[model samples]
Target chain A: MSTTTLQRPATPSAVHLTFGRVVASEWRKLFSLRSTWWTLGLAVLLQVGMAAILGAAARAVAASGQGTLPVDGVQAASAGLQFSQLAIVALAVLTITAEYSSGQIRVTLAAVPRRTPVLLAKALVLTGVVLVTAVVSSALSVGALALVAGEHISFALPGAESARILAGAPLYLVGIAVLSLGVGALMRHTAGAIAALMGFLLVIENVFAAIPWKPLQIISPWLPGTAGSRLMSTDADIAAAQAVPHHVGAVLGAWQGYGVLVAWAVLALVAAVLVLRSRDA
Target chain B: MIEAHGLSKVYGTTRAVDDISFTVRPGIVTGFLGPNGAGKSTTMRMIMGLDRPTSGTVTVNGKPYVEHRAPLTQVGALLEAKAVHPGRTARQHLRVVGATHGLGARRVDEVLEMTGLGPVADKRVKGFSLGMGQRLGIAVALLGDPSTLILDEPVNGLDPEGVIWVRDLVRYLAGQGRTVFLSSHLMAEMAQTADHVIVIGRGRILADAPMATLLAGPGQEASRARAPRATELAAVLRSQGLTVTQTGADTLEIVAGTPAVAEAALAAGIAVHELAPVRASLEDAYLALTADEVEYHSGVGAPANPEVAR
Candidate 1:
């Protein structure tokens, strides 16, 4: 039906837009940029490298038999998250913000006029890519910790505690990545969105959690950063949060913390969708 | 075909696109001509659904652009040049946009070659000159093989060769029963390519007519009189109640009949070197039609519009 009769069917052939194809388009866009791989690689390296380093320190302290090791082997394996999450934050922000910086959003919106699907597709691709990175790096981190400080920290993968720790690491990373994606869409500027997310994760959440007040402590667990951190914590870590004389608050479990993080992501995503549809591209 | 009914856009308090309605028919090239900040881009954006109209609606083919099952197939648009992520290679950019419509690599390569961009298909778009970027934009507009096309300033950054290529391409597409709507600041270029023209100014439609009728204007016959003593001929013609404007040292644009100018020159003993009737070109017609509508005027004759903006 698209045949032009004389010049190569200028209108081409039968083809139409689909949700599946938009997902594919998002995939291609994410992989085409060199920054995506470089930043993601940094995230993996930070996670694994921190796990091994923290595991060795835990082993040394135990060997001397002097003081209580603050973090267990499970916590050590995921400790790299402290630094690796920054990489995830940067990557997620760039995923959506780069389009606006380069004036490509207009072209993208033109292709997919419904607007909401573009954000959904981008979130899906980001989740898929970051999940793979988080899983592989987190696993390697667990292996490295077990290899170096296995006996000292009683590290092994077969137990329920270790399994939850391993699984939670990737989910936590994916959550942070999706959360950053929504913020980036709302703020449309790379540095500005990164600053806002960094402030929320590093400054605001930590400040409220540190204040020695009951109500603030109670509400701290609801903060996305504090809630998300619960996913990677060991029993010792949870106990420490409670032991703080000012820590009279709800003790969130791993999945529960992850659910809170997911809720934050959903809130940001819904706001992005509404703003994107109503505002001019 | 493209239809707009009372489509308007208000950015903050400024009416970027006022209430304007027009039809762009199939099988013809319709030129959207306007001065800077005259709402051409805003109108085109409203039609493409890039910017929502505040008051009314615009539709491509038969329904609103967003309602179409395949928007790219319905109307491919190049609203601005270089609307691409510079970090990605040219081929990658096309592949990503085309994938939304389920268009494959074969078609991607076809468009790359068609736009004369095959050699640089794999190169990042960061280094492309303005002309190359324009070609890439046109390449994107053609990716879906859409039946209706909207290109705003399609030849803004093209070289002479590229300009001619776009003209011939638009004409050929329209000849094949496609709807081609384009906006350009180049008056001579529109005069050459567009069969019908829509003149817009200050967010309003000032003139919408065929090429010939617009150029012919409102039956105000103008004659170009060139004589050795043009000033003397002007004085004689002015006394006869004729509006005359000195276009050159020897040539005068007289808003009168050719016979009157000749008779005045003959009576004044001024040698008439040349005298003939003149039809306004699109540029002249446009300037005359938009004399009062220009947003910003250099000399002190036109009023300034406080609301128009980039």
Candidate 2:
């Protein structure tokens, strides 16, 4: 049993590799990197900070009683989520791509050779961390505004409507993280996967809108970014316009938006699973 | 135990691993010997279930690695050293890997100490030297206390002490009735360490035999004669059931020792200008075995005479 004498115990215990163990392993892997902390920290700051800043600005406008554009409390609470989505995406992409890029995927697969468990474990861990952070950030943003500037903010919707926004925002962010993880699993290169995910979300929808063809412009609403934004924004028109300035009233209803985002994530995850199952690690 | 039947892999236009069937049994140190790009790593990956065989199958214990409930306990593999995130420390890397199979922190710490990585366990792997990285890889492989260990180039970048340590460690493990299947391109090391060897060349198994058989087998010998009659001498040697390949205008390399070839030539009345036995080191035996299968043959001499790839 001396450490210097490397002897594998003659009889190994009847230990099975459970899914819980894989989840624990993945959770450890996720937090062990500096990028995870930096990305998570930056995401929380941006989410809470931007929400407070936007809420304060709108409150100042309402105090003057002249030029205040009505700001919904939920929208004000999640105003920073748009920018912080990049951080969540980064964390998700790194979840899968870092393994591939560093050759750790081989080690991971060798440890859990069933493959699907690894992907599932990663998705679960990512969802858990991102969902918790997003929920906390949204709650803090709303709480901070209520403490400082809640009196001036006009109702986007009161009671349950605002609560829906708070809940839906975290779900939407988790969906994006899952989708990003799928993309990372497929692309396997950190830069390439991140570029593909971000480019599709940020640039492709705009490109579609800029096309002079009306039929092509209609394709933008079904995109992951447009759909996710709908979940965060109470006004579908405003969310559509925000994602692509000229695109107006093209966003799905809140439930439809959730469904589309879920569909996108599921479709991506299924494809990623197939690729992982059939191809070499 | 590890078993493969008609295991092969094809990458685009190249056959990375041709139909190779071999079994690596427990209680022995089996050296997977090959030149670079000889499909040794590919075979190892296939065994680990990291790569799917295009046409065949490989199994560890009694099932494919993926089918095993406890793959880490069944087989420990070091496919590459430093296959870790650069930002994570050595201990963190081991712990993360260990967590998959419910391996405890105590096991991780033990491996860290055993591999001489305890001192730098908390240092980021990006700063690790090649030797340290190799040790970390070994520790990860050992973390599960696997019954079968597959290590690819475990001695690479190690100092003399590390190399000896690995040698003794593997031999000791084999003595304990554990399977140690490790790959290396170094014939000298393999000869010194392996109880058995499976030599491969150009994705094909060139020789699968005991270490003694591989070392004592027929090797290339150069027998020289007058330039005018060298071709005749080669033909005469060939007629005697010896493989004679033309090396130079006046020199013929036969796959036999000097005495047999020289006696035949002398009996045939072909006066040999010179007859010398080329000392066949294990390295020479390897070069001779894989003379024609080398993908990137060096410019020097070019093996004199190449064997026909089977």
Candidate 3:
């Protein structure tokens, strides 16, 4: 064995491209920007801060024996999602669009010429980062609000319900990030993609909801914002249902909402991959 | 070695890079020369696999760039200066690009030092001046120590010292048996650095030969005749089909060798007191070769193509 080893060359024959290294490279690129830190920090703060504020408002109403119902731990912890999704999605969009706007995509493509893997790695990296941050932000908001609104907030939900809601909130956030990354890749422009994303999330679905058309209402329920929120709603709706049974029927069930979101994310990624592979940087 | 065969790129109605073929050999720098919009960048992009050719193929070391096991080791290209995110520090930018090819921190640091960017390596690129940005682009290109370097206008925006540094770097790389292909509109830079030149205009190759051979091709000799009857000498030289222009009261510039002009003067019984040869510069040769293909003509002088002008 020693003699045979001595006859072999000292170095490996070739170094092929590796997905793991590409993902790591993508991670480096994602974190290197100041905007990334600013955007993500704002997302976490918005999530945690809004959650506490809403929890305090709910606590006050409950203490006064007012008309509004008391807020649950899950809902209070996730109150920031309403504001934070904008930051999270915007961060995700900027991750890819920044490269395009600055013409760094050419350098990036020159380095990793296969093209599709780069986009895949970018989406995966964005998902992982957004997931971790979303989980941390969700946990802090819920845990902190639960501590502050002790008597008014109910921790009476089952372990499975609590776990599902807590875990589902981050997953929902991940879906939003991945979907936005796809949109960024597709548009390859920052302001334009962000505008399109906000228009779809803020205007189209809500506008359709008020259209008074039954088929249009069907489209509204499946919109990304509505379906994404439902990932949290399925379990949270159960807690709300316990207090007022009428609220339970208003949401898309947990898996169904996740299914819609996952479908949008998958389809968007598929389209992004196709476009990115075919087009010049 | 980089080899391109019938490579072409068509953007909409414009054939940015029409069917063209050339080979860049190792051990010397090959300069790519073209006027603005002459498809030098497009051809370079196709060679690097950054732009897909509308037809034909280009290969580096007998394989397409994307098909190579380690492409960064095969060729290093600087397609644009500062093709980096403005927010990323130069060090971070190099590290990320280096990571794609499994290059380590040591290699990144070495290139930064090589490009003289060590002082500003940690500064965000947004604060970098154009010269510093060009240096960073070179640093990124040199990361993997690739055998072939394709730089498009690498010295652009560089100060005199920076320009000299890049000239030495490419020459040193080529002297080590690497293939160095670069493009520049600066003919003086090309004349000094390139061992061979492939000139293109309007998406077509106008000349491809050794640097000396291209400079020696045509318009390499002109003669100045100082004669009392300079106007008569100019008329006689023009009748012989040589372009002769009067410079001063007693001098005529003949687009021919001194010996030929002296013989003509002697035949015409014109006493020539001074006959000196004027060497043709590379700029003259380049202009003569690309005279008809220039996209935008100034229209200040005689029409380049009188038929079209009419």
Candidate 4:
């Protein structure tokens, strides 16, 4: 057991109260809670499980020489990442919304009066955790898949394509996590945030895609999940450009897709911060 | 010290808290007295920045709560019985809050010990009884050794022993020159613990004065004259320009100058069977102030008082 004596100076200096301290405090809070560990564990499980199954299936097809590899080995290895994104998104939303549900958000805001710093701190920590987990999970998934499949499926390591996939996968997850976190702040309810996230990803975006309106088709790639998915699969753009009628690259250039995803993440985060600062917890 | 300047809050159409203002001074326990739904919780929430006021502002020391650097070090508040996640252990909860200010594990354990939670600090909060949860909330309030403390109904679920402990704890905190502001409908408890009192009724300030003054003031003297056949006394007092009411057949309440005056009247050949001075209990005074503003009046008839029936 640890005991702390009262050590506040007779007069506390202003230097001790800063955004840096808030960030540090938020980081501690983010990791100290048990939910963080659970989410990370789920991320790892999904990454490894999805990668192994897809790698095995790809290897069987490649060994028989039945047809050219339908997807790149790296992409196959990272297939599980799509499922793991849900866990990351859930973790991010819960980090803020749970406080609201339990009536503890007021305590948090009281402790740190500058609401933006608190939100920013949470976002930074979420991004850091999600990125680290995504990278490590992607690496392990790819490595394990290669080991199981043998030499038939080979992908260059640290190469431009591999780097893009590796870097972009985590970035995409972090972007999605931020976007969800913003929505969570705006909604201030776990059920509402989760519902909105699912509605946007599963229903709204698809509805937009199915619409016959030409303008809607042009705007479809800007949807949060769609933009994120394309960003993580840069190689798909090159493949679609050669084999498909509707050139994916023309609809949204590689850089343009990345920009759209980042813009969505940033816009959501800004709106969340504005609402958090101006409105009551 | 904590000060509120024209603080008010509105929830849609209902005015939860009106333009009320009061001050809580250091080195004393200030009891915020009100019945249920008197905006006590809403006012406290605003002070903690959990709820933004519709108008005006509240400041601890000289600045708003959010503007204060080292907020945990400046003020500690126990606004709820169990503002904790069930999966986290008591020690973990303390440690997490402590870590915000860069405090070490030692501080967490000290607070656990202080609140008598050391034995169960390792246990998950899910298994805690209501009393244990209240203790944890107090422990969190004490975690920062803050100079200002705000506790809303700190004794709600406490056992007898736990209740006594909280009483002593608040007194001790005040003794250390800290500002302790607490709200409770338990007037007896407030009578014992608070040095000053702030009574709110329907989100408006009904009274703010020293506990001694409030207890010995107008309301107390009026209730002392209630008794059967006291209408004669009311008639006599009315002739003397004193406001009087016959509460019951045997009760005549007189809001006269003082106990000595009422005693003098009885001595001057008044048929006074009961000259008992109705020193208003804190409970009576509180009810009197908030009676009109009680949001949910249970219309169920009161159970017959056996002593009164006799």
Per-model TM values vs. the true structure: 0.92, 0.85, 0.91, 0.85
What are the clashing pairs of model 1?
A: none
lDDT (10s digit) by residue, model 4, range B221-254: 5445544556666677777777777777867666
Fraction of native Cα contacts kept in each candidate?
0.91, 0.84, 0.64, 0.41
* Root mean square deviation (Cα) for candidate 3: 5.2
Query: Per-residue lDDT for B244 in model 4?
Result: 76
Q: What is the C-alpha lDDT profile of model 3 across B247-305, one tens digit per residue?
A: 99999888899989988888999899899988666677788998988787766785443
Estimate the TM-score for candidate 2.
0.85
Candidate 2 lDDT over residue span B1-310, tens digit each:
9999999899998999999999999999999988788899999999998888988999889898877777888898888989998999999999999887778879988999888888899999999988898999999888888899999999998999999999998998899999999998767888889999898988899999888888777755544444458999989989999888788888777778788987898799888887776656667677778888888766686552232111
Expressed as tens digits, the lDDT of each residue in B117-220 for candidate 1 is: 99999999999988889889998999999999999999887999999999999999999999999998788999999999999998999999998889888757
Deviation from truth (RMSD, Å), model 2: 7.4
CAPRI tier for the interface of model 2: medium
Which digits, one per residue and each the tens of the lDDT, describe model 3 over residues A1-281? 11122223323323335666677789999899889999989999998888777767767887898844455577668867877888988999998999988889988888888787788888889888998899889889887787666667776667787677778778988888889999999998999999998888878867976787667766776887887777666455545644764432244677787888989998998899888877877
Checking candidate 2 for backbone clashes, the offending pairs are none
lDDT of 4 by residue, A148-230 (tens): 77766667544787777767778888888999899899888898898788778878888887887777777787887777666
Give the docking tier of candidate 4.
acceptable
lDDT of 2 by residue, A1-281 (tens): 11112122322454557777788899999888889999998888898888778777877887887766466777888878777888999999999999988999999989888788888888899889999999888888888777667677655586676777888878988999999999999988889988888888778877875776877667777888777777666655555555875654465777787888889998988899889988988
- Isolated chain A TM-score, each model: 0.88, 0.86, 0.86, 0.86
Residues A244-276 of candidate 1: C-alpha lDDT, one tens digit per residue: 774477888777888999999999988988898
Candidate 2 C-alpha error for residue B235, in Å: 26
